[model samples]
Target: MAFAVSILRLAISTAVFPIFLLHFLGLWDWICKKLFPHFMVQFSKSYNKEMAAKKQELFGNLHEFAGSSGKLALMEVGCGTGANFKFYPPGCRITCIDPNPNFEQFLIESIAESRHLQFERFVVASGEDMHQIADNSMDVVVCTLVLCSVQNQEKVIQEVHRVLRPGGAFYFLEHVAAEPSTWNFFWQQVLRPSWFLMFDGCDLTKESWKPLEKANFSKLKLQHLQAPLSWKIVRPHILGYAMK
Candidate 1:
């Protein structure tokens, strides 16, 4: 009976693998490019206020920064629905980078609601490759819940460093790998593959903060905490700033 069950599992795995590949290449991209942004826009509204308060506290000294006579050149990588716009200082000019073009409309709507922030440009490009943004040009770079899904996190960090001016800071909030000994960690690892496939490459168990700590940033201030109880599989989170 056990042998028969093993054979059945093997057959199921073989059957599912091909379809997964096809979907990952085509349908997955479509969903990520289209449906995901709409879902994220609404989802962000539900929890952004709480998250934004935490972000404000973490970014204590920098929260009210209005760069260079109120013309801050801020760039947000993966600025999903512009959830962080309200936290920005008044009269700041923002460059939004997101891989999903569908997010532009949402971003525009959010910008319209913002009192102090203004849109400069929207680039539909991955964090790993943002050559259009020149080196050492931005006053600040913001990334939240982004590093977990990028193709190469180290490369994305490098790009963030390259684009930031000396004394500029990179603000981040990301869900990370849970404590290794915990049951949550086990579930995180077990769910990672399916989670990645369903959620646009988000890896539930990625130790995203390790690369940030190892990077050549001038200073790193970070704190780790568990997210809300509802986010069971990806609850471990890190938030802070890395100065360039």
Candidate 2:
């Protein structure tokens, strides 16, 4: 059984590295737009429903936060291939930051050429330092699947808190370590070294949740979900909203 598990892991890793390379090369755009927007949109739509429901549940308690002033100043930390561009609400001003300048250039060029756009504005830099966004001014900050690769998660979380207005919301999608999964635990431990070095220091099992809870968010709306076929090894995600 152990030998079989090892072989399976090797096979998975071999297949996984190519996908990582595509992400590193920022080629998800070509794949999503040319080859797979249909599948991508469907998956995102499914997640959006669940995420929106999570947000709506606490609308009453979070009126001040959820109630935007009809104008949104948004930021996407680690924007990747700008996948979240399709998720933005109209009229929201956007600024996205990513360490990979090459990727950022690609994102800007894509937006310039593309027909459909959901973001209001876009920028390329480190999200940990939103030196451009004024303090207590932004309406919403979209941080989907970003915290994992950040070197200083605490610093960035603090920065997010600092930039948000008194009632602004920071909506996030994150993957953290899973519970009670022995094989998953092993994979995280075994691959910790290579995963980080190869993928901008993104550890599959990094704990980015506790600090967010401890942050200045007045109300936190959080949910966890596991992906279908991760061998129950890779942590799936938690989509949540926190208000300043």
Off by over 4 Å in 1: 1-25, 63-66
Q: Which lDDT tens digits does candidate 2 get at residues 1-244? A: 4565576657666757765677669974355334332333354555545555443442323224333455456666776666555445444456777655556545665466444444555555676777876787666676765788777788888888888888778878777776645666667655664555454556788776788888878998787777443235444667678888
Please give, for residues 1-244, the per-residue lDDT of candidate 1 as tens digits: 4454456545654556754675757766675567788778777876675566686776565544445665778899999899888877777789999998888898888988996777899999999999999999988899988999998999999999999988889999898999987877766655565567667788888899899999999899889997663567766899988989
Whole-structure CA lDDT of model 1: 0.82
Candidate 2 clash pair list: 94-121
Q: RMSD in angstroms, candidate 1?
A: 3.9
Q: Supply candidate 1's per-residue lDDT for 182.
A: 82
Model 2: CA > 4 A from native: 1-69, 113-121, 229-233
RMSD in Å for all candidates: 3.9, 6.3
Clashes of each: 0, 1
Best-matching candidate per TM-score: 1
C-alpha lDDT (0 to 100) for residue 147 of candidate 1: 93
How does each model score on TM-score?
Answer: 0.87, 0.69
